[model samples]
Target: MPSAHTKSPRAASRTPLIEVTKLSKVYVNDAVETPVLFDIDLRVQSGEFMAIMGPSGSGKSTLMHILGFLDRPTHGKYRFLGKDTAGRTDDELAIIRATKVSFVFQAFHLLPRATVLENVMLPLLYHPTIPSAERQHRAQAAINAVGLFERTNFLTSQLSGGQKQRTAIARSLVTEPQVIFADEPTGNLDSVSGIQVMGALEKLHASGHTIILVTHERSTAEFADRIVHILDGRIASDSRSHSRRSSSGLTSLK
Candidate 1:
């Protein structure tokens, strides 16, 4: 396991966009306490592509939850863009998540009755700072980026599996967040669809978006620059790849 203080010389010299120290999470039910994560320490530089991989019950999901700010840790500290998240209130966390983080899931999670454009515009509903016209413009751009501009008027249910997932990706990207947390993004798609989705993600990574992917698939993990393997609530390995540059000059493992 890598310690916060033991970063490689290359890593030590860089400023981290996301940092976690001694992170742990425990679930308790009826006085039965089970720890889902141990003392995990991690640092992700801006625009880095990372994959968090593990077998079932290895606490990868728990770690993802923590990383996404969807769940709090039992102990340890999280700092985002140099701000400590340890004592932040739920409202504060929500604000941070809304402005800084975006999420992609295996399930499209689109509103079945909504058009592709409308679904992509969902995040803007919570952002009072963006004017309606700007929201629409950004939404259209995101949809276009995902190659779904032609289907913007079609309901999510009218699309094929890959198209639906593409719409979902557009929605996540609509926010223009600093970080994207994706959990099994290709799990529900066929091989071809998965490849298309991965290609889309690769484009985003190239555009300097920080991405953290949670997956069990080796092939999927290979898309990232760095791979962090977890097991039994602990980190097993953190490996880097050779092809380390994204299109935007973002570092990748391989």
Candidate 2:
């Protein structure tokens, strides 16, 4: 039997940026335990675009939360950038989450009152290491990357749904994170808007940013180089897409 940390032979030479081994999560209240994720094993290489697809109750969001360091797993190992996160402190995890990983959500979690540029600069506030003067430059570059430069001075409320999503993406990029976790980025947008959002993400991927997307829509998942299907808290299938092959032509999630 394969161990919980198993990887395909084809991926042996490449180092995984994020590795999850026998990972599981459970919610406990009043001494009652509810398992939300099974013994999940996954490995994501740097610069790869991956999508996690599952129905409403399949635990995809739970998995993303755990992987993104927003929540901890009840059991198993989660290694980020080759460091095991089993006993890390919350502050340590927070630093890693803030600096190395970024997240975009379905709700577009932007401050309605803030301008698009301000919202994009929000992540830099937590990153004290970035010089104050450099923050604006980075934020502006991020907004431009998402094609929202024209709306940077506009209040977030003034932007369209697609532009709001772009601002969210811009905020995520302000930190120049190594990985991005997007949960239903286009969930609230129309088909055309969703396509634009996906296009922005695809452009990011082309720029060598690793992305993990969680979506129920097959059309959205099609943007990923590889897709993992989850069913009842377990991975049903992990496969590469013929339409989005990697540069090496060996993108495999086994």
Query: Which lDDT value does model 1 have at 26?
Result: 97
TM-score of each: 0.90, 0.91
Q: All candidates' lDDT scores? A: 0.84, 0.87
Please write out the lDDT profile of model 2 over residues 1-254, one tens digit for every residue.
22222234545566678899999889999999988899999888888889999999899999999989999999999998888988889998888887999999999999999999999999999885898899999999999999987898999999999999999999999998999999999999986777788888988988889999999988788789888999989999988866752312222221
Clashes of 2: 0
Clashing pairs in 1: 225-252, 225-253, 241-253, 241-254
In lDDT terms, how accurate is model 2?
A: 0.87
Model 2 TM-score is 0.91
lDDT of 1 by residue, 22-74 (tens): 99999999999999999999888877789999998999989998888899999
- For model 2, where is the 10-residue window of minimal lDDT? 245-254
Q: Give the clash count for each candidate.
A: 4, 0
Cα-based lDDT at residue 8, candidate 2: 45
The model with the greatest lDDT is: 2
Off by over 4 Å in 1: 1-14, 242-254
Model 1 clash count equals: 4
